[model samples]
Target: MINACLLNDDDTLKLVSVAAGSTLPTNTIWLDVNQPDDEERQWLEKLLIEDVPDEDEMDDIESSSRFRVGPDGVHILSLFPQRLANDTRGVNMSFTMRKNLLLSFREDDVSIVRLLRYYIRHGKANIRSALDILLSLQDLKVDQLSDMIEDAYSTLDETADTIIEEGHVEENLEELVRQEELNGQILQALYDSRRALRFIKKTFESSLDDRQNRNIDEMLNDIESILPHTQFLANKINFQLEATMGYTNHKQNKIIKIFSVAAVVFMPPTWIASLYGMNFKFMPELDWRFGYPLSICMMILSAGATYLFFRKKGWL
Candidate 1:
């Protein structure tokens, strides 16, 4: 789908749905192309007079390919955070910025885009140029990343409490693993955003006005502040993982210790019983009247002594 965002004379934003073969409005400031079909892609290519990056190209990780200057504009392929039902992941989105036009290409629906659109439609966003839209998206992305980091912090705190209390160690470990993955994605998104911002700053330093420069600086600072939290969370997650595993091992060893003590406690009684059960006709104990009671008493005494010995040695 292709949505064109146009700025009105009254400084309000209008969202237009550009169908295949339809000419984009001349006043459009931003063109958002999401999972375009073949016809839409053709229409976009025709409108922009250049080919859009495909899914594979957008997924490229090489810095040279991901960030570049071309005849079309400043091309940037950056990772954005996408929330799943149980976890978060990074989704790559391509951006091409011209002096008066900004185009975004993505295969997935990112919340940042939706939120930016909503803000624009509601007159909550102050967008003066295409570069402003790009900066606004980056700003919103940093806010979302901060929110995600806060959530990860809360989750880790709860997981730590669960681990320390020894409640559901297995479940907590699993949750920590998932949290680790989410934190990793957040870190990746932050790094990508920083790199993209730095590239834009360097490439457009001469063109950026005071406001845009300050915006970029603030975002860089925000990213710097949020980065340490991610590292702390990563370390905390690892520590919790190890702690959970140790707790599990301690519980398992306790169980094994009980079995070991029990086995040792019963060994003497078992041996005595086996000796008495031997069917030799010349066995002296069989001829004694009180032999059965004597053997039973001995078995009980032996078991008791073994148990007491264990207790005395503090191995129980």
Candidate 2:
């Protein structure tokens, strides 16, 4: 969007095309323009008596634009986490000239457009006013980080403080599930924190002044302070998840042991029957009248020996 702020005061408001913005009765004019048509750009071009900076030219504005044109100590092009790029909670981009005018062009940044409109409406679109607005935005961003982590810390702390153990089996499992949820939330918050830091870092990289740099550092510090706590919470979640897995494995092993024992207990009987079933004509044992009874006894003895062996080996 394109926003115009005329920062010419009554005493210094002199209209002489384009010169240095050293003095003037600043008249602030702010507008919100999105996808500015050719006609709109022409209008802006006429009003400013200067060419409008296109999005392409303004992509890495700090890199392309001169120090004089860029915001003091603040780079015009700052990278945000990819997540923020999709965020719709946009802020207004402000435009301010030294009591002269501010012409802002943002075809992709919606929040900046909103901010421009809000500040202009509130009589806060002058060059000084615009700087104030931007500072407030930085502050707001910092505040956002603080609030998000603060709430997170409190919730995690509460969970850590209390343990609900006496309930139905499902309840116990549900608690584990809840812990998983908490961890997920914490990870999300961490992602957000990182995103904000990236954005701040991008802003600082282009900054040409100390004030803006300080702002970026402040934001980074905020993220850093919470990192340890967030990391711990994440670790706690992982530990819990691992412990739950161990219990599940133990239960499975016990079940497998029971099945194995049953198989072993019947294996000896199976061997004895298979041996007798080999009814060859030259089999003396089979020809004897007591052979069948002897085979049965032999099978019982084999079964007993196998069982004892298994018991002694602690296979069960």
Candidate 3:
């Protein structure tokens, strides 16, 4: 769907829905194309006087494909965090800026866009230019990432406590790996945003005012702060993983030790039985009635001796 928001003469924002045949309002300042149909895409292309990239093009990771500067203006393809039912991740989004207009295309909704809308509707933002809106979106995206990191910190704390206090990670290897993967995703998203911001800062070096530059600098600082946080979480996860492996090794060793001690305890009995079973017609003990009783006594004594030896050596 195509959703357009126009800034009015009275400094208020008005939202408009642009359908297949609907005309784009002349005062439109921001146009959001969400999972646009072919007709809507064509309309946007015509309105913006530039070709709208397809989903595949938007997903490109190369610097050249991600950002471009032209006589008209700058085009940026960025990845923003999207929360899934079970996980949070980054999704590619396309933004085109020309003069006072900013157009965004995404296959799905993102919190950045939602937050932007909330600010505009509540008159809490003074969005004077397309770049202003972009900066505001970036600010909100950073906040979202920070919140995710805070949650990860809490989880890692709990995981560490479980291992220290309860003496177990209480999760299989797969579960631990999944958490690591999630942390990696959050780290990647932060990196992508940082790259995008730096590119923007460099591209329009002279156009930005002191306030805009400070805002961008503040954003960079925020991302810098978050980067270390993710690194800390990663280290903690690795520690937990190692702790899990150590516990597994301990348990396995205990089982092996039990079997080894059992074998040692049984050795003497097996040896006495084997010695008596030897078929020898000339053996006097074979005919003796007390032979079996004597053999049993020898086996008991040998077994007890072995057990005591192991206990003294602390190998029991």
Q: Pick the candidate with the highest TM-score.
A: 1
Task: Estimate, for each residue in 1-316, the C-alpha lDDT of model 2 and write its tens digit.
Answer: 3334444544221222322222322354323345677876766655553466566654433424422333322223322111142121222232323221334445555443355446555665433434434444445544554554465456545544443332332443455465455445544444444553455455436542576566656766766776676567667656654555565677779899888877787787888889789867788887799999988888788778878888899775
Q: State model 2's lDDT.
A: 0.50
Q: Can you write out model 3's per-residue Cα lDDT over 156-192, one digit (the tens) per residue?
A: 7767666644435565355567668878888887887
lDDT of 1 at 171: 85
Pairing residues by index, what is the TM-score of model 2?
A: 0.46
lDDT values, one for every candidate: 0.90, 0.50, 0.82
CA RMSD of all predictions: 1.5, 9.5, 2.2
lDDT of 1 by residue, 99-145 (tens): 78999999999999999989987889989888899999999999999
Ordered by lDDT, highest first, the candidates read 1, 3, 2
- Go through the candidates in order and give the clash count of each: 0, 34, 0
Off by over 4 Å in 1: 164-167
Off by over 4 Å in 2: 1-128, 146-220, 244-252, 255-259, 284-315
Ranking by TM-score: 1, 3, 2
Worst 10 residues of 1 by lDDT: 161-170
Pitting candidate 1 against candidate 2, the one with the higher TM-score is: 1
- On the 0 to 100 scale, the lDDT of residue 229 in model 3 is 84
